[model samples]
Target chain A: METLIFDLDAKPLREVNQFLHGDASGLNGKAFVIENPNGAHSIAVGLKSDIHVTVKGHAGYYAAGMNQIAKVTIEGSAGSGVAENMMSGMVHVKGFASNAAGATANGGLLVIDGDAGLRTAIALKGADVVVGGSVGSFSAFMAQAGNFVILGDAGEGLGDSIYEAKIFVRGKVKSLGADCEEKTMNPEDRKILADLLAKSGHAGVNPDSFKQYGSARTLYHFHVDNAGAY
Target chain B: MSEQQPKIPQTKPRFSATFDESTMSEIRRAAATGIYDIRGAGAKRKVPHFDDLLFLGASVSRYPLEGYREKCATDVVLGARFAKKPIHLKTPVTIAGMSFGSLSANAKEALGRGASAAGTSTTTGDGGMTQEERGHSSILVYQYLPSRYGMNPDDLRKADAIEVVIGQGAKPGGGGMLLGQKITKRVAKMRCLPEGIDQRSSCRHPDWTGPDDLEIKIAEIREITDWEKPIYVKIGATRPYFDVALAVKAGADVVVLDGMQGGTAATQEVFIEHVGIPILAAIRPAVQALQDLGMHRKVQLIVSGGIRNGADVAKALALGADAVAIGTAALIALGDNDPHLEEEYQKLGTTAGAYDDWHEGRDPAGITTQDPELMKRLDPVKAGHRLANYLAVMTMEAQVIARACGKSHLHNLEPEDLVALTLEASAMAKVPLAGTNWIPGVTGF
Candidate 1:
């Protein structure tokens, strides 16, 4: 597996598609660089194989949206919807990511080096998005089954209208979202997050620094008096 | 109850009209045909809304901030450039996007003038940006609708910010529909469609289907503009938490949430009232989504629909909205349903308070009316100035409340500063009871 270099000056989209349009599936052993990323968004979207795509600088919206099975990483910040609707893959952001990172994702590991914007991992079916920093409010709203772990403070209304997804936060939450609630930290949570952190390269993080939140299943179905106002 | 055996009345009128002869005649005509009661919002009945949510005023516990003597910050920034410049508004209360085809050019320009005068922004609606509106408004936000009518590079580059109109509060899942009756020659040209064609704007973006595509679409937009403009995703307030998250994921610089009470030029009445959440209910979740991302204020959040006056603005801010946008209120300021048009409204078969027929284009007031005569009734200069005054008052009011709440800036208003008048208000506001600290935690407000 030879390393492929895509300089910022080079428009790799055509070439990258050349390989993808063909059958070059796994680019893991190769180091791909989108040099001087400078907010060039969507480096590799909808790539359905385990390839490694490293965006050197900032990438714009949906940096790696709906990624199927590729391991896509960005060196700098990512704009909104990084790894959106991603179906099974690994996405890493060395810097901050805009709102809704890993939204509606299923079966993937999304790691953000820094903070994430609002509604990160919303309605996540099975994706796991680990943030190195804080998250905005309503993170993981209506998330059915996934893990959203935040290392920094959580914004107001965290986890409102969530489903069965698990949320672990190391920081303070301004408020909880409608129908979302704090749950008792069980041993399963501790083990799962610890293993996840180690696998995602945050091996030494203190698991105790996090708290878990999820839906109480009260607002999912509307009641006349308790009709879901949202 | 039927013991009296009410005899079947002979074929006559549906009922005797209690209204005057003219009103009866109009009703008879409407009955003889069809298509009556053509307005927006809760046609079934009225409810106390943001309009009814009044402030407690200066009292023993609070002091009134000077209306004009004090330094009240009203500036608001929205949308990071996708390829261009971010939008900068004079006040937090912006005029929401209302289409050009749906409204007369003078009316659109009036909104821009009014918004500019008050030092705020006015947004373009489903119909792409109009040069007249843009030239008039200091801060003009161009909207990209599902229809994509008149969309091209020049307008995209010219806009301060671009709003991706995924949905609206009035009819979230529906698209822009201009009945053939409303389609004019100029509208046809601007839209690049034949004149007098009933345009059923695609309910969804013709090119992009899901969020994944939207992400690319947003990037393409950025590329087209050379990364100088900010992108905003405007969603009708339905499943706000998820939508907010999706919007954030979509890389929106701002997430604009429009509530159920939002105004629509043309949409099914049922959809307007039956679908979507209220602006009050939508704010907390949206703010929370930002907070969850650790980008609450960093990725600005603007809320609209049912926002009226200073108190509603303050409440939205306190509830976690970075800024507020108004459509109907701005229209009212431009004389949408002025009582002065009462007789004319009667002729239109609607009352001032009962008006909802924005789609008819027969508005006696120039606000929503497209009739040349009706549009002429509203002097753009005068109406524009009036809108400015009203916007100023709203900004002042928000600032005063924020100051009283001990925050120097309007955006600093928070849930801690408010108490709800009713449990419904309290719950919707996500605030505690007026006299109690307890929120039904288990039930969850």
Candidate 2:
């Protein structure tokens, strides 16, 4: 496979983005290596085609934003909104992620290998998120539709105002947010978790260790009794 | 015996000013339902508006042109500040943003068709862009709201312009709410939420907190679109002076100012009535801010809220706005709350003119509902024609006014030709009262 190398210290971000955005069809299915990203903002944003991009170092805000039909792997820590609004692609962060790691993404898969910061997957639409470690407070806030798998502990206020999205956690939980509570894990849920773990490259882990959480379905209609929750 | 007693004149029954009938009814309804009343539309309470301003037709000092012979220009160009391609409109009136979830697909299509026919731009609201709108509209402006629902880069590039909405006039600092009943499968899918669930949009954007961050956000949008589309910053009329100045400093090509009289799909009644300033009080301050920065007319201003007729449009242009946008009026022109639907409206426990329960998704006129049966009642083609006809009439009416004012173009109608009827209106519009050279709160009256 043809490989392209971009050294951030040697070239300006605009120059690299210009080349990347410009007709990259010749390098279809090729690998792109980015060195010294060094927590820069908006690196590899709006990538539309199917290709492989590997960032050798830490990436900054909105890294791999609006990604579609591409595979992006970050080797080091990632800043806020990594893989935001992604559609039909995969983004794997090998290290810790900052806040709002997949905010408002409609379709895609985001895999975080380390601890995720606050509000991870806030307003996430259909992106499947798998966090390998613990997450901060307000994880999965207002999540609509998706599967969020947490392998470790969770902080407070998880899944506030949550909708149809399902949450599975293997470790301890701090507390649940409004309209969110623990749900019984059935065989179908176990099967879904097994598939998610397999897709996230954690197939060795047992699915029986996880607990499921989702919306209580009480806030679907307006009622005066629920005014305090609002 | 009762008929005989009624023949004599009796003293008129006195009513309580503090606890009126409407107030007592509201209390009773709240006690019975145990929830605050939620509805659509703008404030019903009267406020100072463009109706308070009158134009002085030319008599001697100003020469009036022949009504049919004079050529009055109504063309307006927007976003010439930085964009390579700016918007050119045949008329100064454009359609304001109303989301797909808040309105039916047919309604959006009709709006696109009408705006295209009128040679003006139509905007996408909170939910995001729809194919029906893009396919039919000749010029479409995409709104970037705090919710960021269904926002993607591809659509941003496809848009003719981008409007970053900081606030709307109906609820300045409040979040938007879509009740569960209106959240159909398609709306939910577009918004990335569960079907039939109440969706609450955040009041503030997650990324930027202030003007400094706003600059970066605008830059990012510019980069995404390759600096092609014009960016507009929209704010509710709270502190128009400061907001307009800040938006200009943040590198906006256009500023959209919405006043408190603006209509909303759904919001708390209290917030809608008592949150922001009137448009009459807002335009002068905004224009002053633009002048202070030496950007007046350079940075286009589009004002909305209570604009109804061509007279309102002419009055707005005189107040220094480049153009005017209409929301409630546009919906009305599309047959919303039409008298023909009076029988259906009565079944919902309200009259057609008084109906405002749009959030429930049971719109009989089919303009604001997602239900397939209700939506089918509206023919986009017919509705589009009606809207186009209404727009044509408004434009003609404005031209008549412009000719009477002896102005060759609608933009030439200045505040000097206007006179206010009340002290408050005179101060708000910064114009003198009729038959008097004195303007209240300015100099010696």
Best by lDDT: 2
Q: Which residue pairs of candidate 2 clash? A: none
lDDT of 2 at B130: 98
Q: What is the lDDT of residue B432 in candidate 1?
A: 68
lDDT of 1: 0.75
lDDT of 2 by residue, B1-445 (tens): 4555457787999889988998899899998998888878777778999999999989989998788887899999898998778889999999998999999999999999998999889999999999999998999999998888888778988999999999998889887888988899999888877788778887876554689768767766765665678899989999999999999999999999999888888997888888898999999999999999999999999999999999999999999999999999999999999999899999999898888898889999999899999999989999988888888888888888988999999999999989999888899989998889888888677
Against the reference, the lDDT scores of all candidates come to 0.75, 0.88
Candidate 2 C-alpha error for residue B377, in Å: 2.2
How large is the interface RMSD of candidate 1? 13.2
Chain A TM-score of model 1 versus the true structure? Answer: 0.92
Poorest 10 consecutive residues of model 1 chain A by lDDT?
A220-229
Model 2 agreement with the true structure over A78-180: per-residue lDDT tens digits: 9877887777689999999998888777778999999999888877777889999999898888887788999999999999888888899999989999999
For every model in order, what is the number of clashing pairs?
Answer: 49, 0
